[model samples]
Target: MLDDFMTRATLAGVGTALAAAPLGCFVVWRRMAYFGDATAHAAILGVALSLAFSMPIFVGAMIVALVMAAAVTLLTGRGYAMDTLLGVMAHSALAFGLVAVSFLSGVRIDLMAYLFGDILSVSHVDLAVIWGGALLVVALVAWRWSALLTATLNPDLARAAGIDPRREQLVLTLALAVVVAVAIKVVGVLLITAMLIIPAATARPFARTPEAMAAFAVVLAMVAAWIGLQTSYQFDTPTGPTIVCVVAVMFAVSSIASTLRRAG
Candidate 1:
């Protein structure tokens, strides 16, 4: 089954969705959408550095993403607006990454692949990385689920219960970096946060509990991945953006249904 490129691509997409949906729940709950973008955008710089240093792209992306996430976490609430901080760092990192990539002489790199993804060309090694990273993220999030929830819902309450909200934030920061590293291959940097945000957002209107929301987001995400791959194959459209488009459509439908249900 993995012999086929399509099979590999589908599995990669599903793996990415698996990891992204649950973490995306935290992202939505914490209103860390911009934070996600910043981490993802910084991944381009990682790609450049990886090519320059001749290391694995995953290692470079992971290292740079961790650094970016840590920087954002550290600088948050240090006398600047969150959006402003993210906007500055996010665009600057992307601009710098593009420039850095341009400076790598004799290397014919496809910026579009890193920016928008090249999922249809995924290989067995890629599958291993995607699923391995996905499972690791799932385990990490599950292990910290209760503590993370407590911190998110009420930091003071979490403190009263002996859970440090800062620690939980670090857990999320680490997880976000991992997701960005793994997903850079699947959806690329530009659209990684979309995969993270859309599934969780689409699942929100129907889920009454955090667990339910995460599960629904996973299902919605996998379905979007499958449908998006199929649609892209059928229409010869871009795979990464197509997957995001499908999820966005799901989000719109879910939102409309939720609105009608509430109205009725």
Candidate 2:
């Protein structure tokens, strides 16, 4: 099964979707979409670091993503606006990463692969990393689901219940970093947040409970992955963007259905 490139690509997409679904719900609930962008954009710097230092891309990306997330979390309560801070950090990190990549002389690199992904080129080792990271994220989120939900719903109420909202935020930060790291090869830096946000958002209108929403998101993400791969393969389009486009279409259809239901 691993001998086939399509099989590997499909599994890679599924693994990334599994990790992103639950975390994406939290992103939507907390209105942290831009935050996801910031962390994902920082992944370019991670790629640069990995190449320069001769380390694994996942380790380098995870470390840089964690730093970016921690920086945002720490600086959020300071003077600068959250949006302003994220914009500056995200763009700056991406620019620096690109410049840094340029500085690596004699080493030919395809920036497109890191920027937009090369999922078809994924190997057996890559599959293992993706699945491992996915399972870890799922377990972490599951372990703290109740506390995380409470914190997301009402930080004050969470505090009243002795669940520290800040701690839950940290868990999310860690999970987001893991997703970005593992998903880099699947969706690349530019589209990681899309994989995270789109499925969850699409599932939103149809779900009555948080758990239901997450389950629907997983299903929708899986569907998008499979369909997107087929579409991209048939048309020879960029796979990562095609996947995102597919999910965006799903979101549009879901929104229309929701609006109609409300009207009816």
Which sections of candidate 2 miss by over 4 Å?
Answer: none
Q: Compose the digit string of candidate 2's lDDT tens values, residues 1-264.
A: 799999999999999999999999999999999999999999999999999998899999999999999999889969999999999999999999999999987777789999999899999999999999999999999999999999999999999999999999999999999999999998899999999999999999999999999999999999999999999999999999999999999999999999999999
Residues 116-223, candidate 1, lDDT per residue (tens digit)? 999998888878988999999999999999999999999999999999999999999999999999999889999999999999999999999999999999999999
lDDT (0-100) at residue 16 of candidate 1? 98
Residue pairs whose backbone atoms clash in candidate 1? none
lDDT for model 2: 0.95
Error of 1 at 227 (Å): 0.2
- Which 10 successive residues of model 1 have the least lDDT summed? 121-130
lDDT of 1 at 99: 99
Question: Residue 234 of model 2: what lDDT?
Answer: 100
Error of 2 at 90 (Å): 0.5
TM-score of each: 0.99, 0.99
